[model samples]
Target: MLQSVELASTSADVLIMAAAVSDWKPSDVSQQKIKKDG
Candidate 1:
């Protein structure tokens, strides 16, 4: 499973039950970047 969230000012709670959780998050995301080229 994969999940993405804008962690600006939010709290998160995770529950663990005999499973592995691999979290991969970018260090920083550009706020003003061009997404397409034409």
Candidate 2:
């Protein structure tokens, strides 16, 4: 969130940021589909 605010404060006309966020994967890969609680 701080990064986003700092980005807007940038004086540069062209800002190129290649920020990559990795997805959170389960500890184990299950062949069966996971169930959700109601």
Candidate 3:
């Protein structure tokens, strides 16, 4: 169950849902940046 739809209603065989108010959950996520270690 992976939900987040609407790229022109997914080629029109509908089962639509809304409200995915996005920022994709970003609160300074880092695996390869923000470095200050010397």
Best by lDDT: 2
* Per-residue lDDT of model 2, residues 1-38, tens digit only: 77886878687777555654664566899899989999
User: How does each model score on lDDT?
Assistant: 0.52, 0.73, 0.66
Give the range where candidate 1 is weakest over 10 consecutive residues by summed lDDT. Answer: 1-10
lDDT-best of 1 and 2: 2
Q: Best to worst by lDDT, what's the order?
A: 2, 3, 1
lDDT of 3 by residue, 7-28 (tens): 5656787675565779368887
lDDT, candidate 2, residue 37?
90
* TM-score top scorer: 2
Instruction: List candidate 2 stretches off by more than 4 Å.
Output: 1-25
15 in model 2: Cα distance from truth in Å? 11
RMSD per model, one decimal: 13.8, 5.9, 8.5
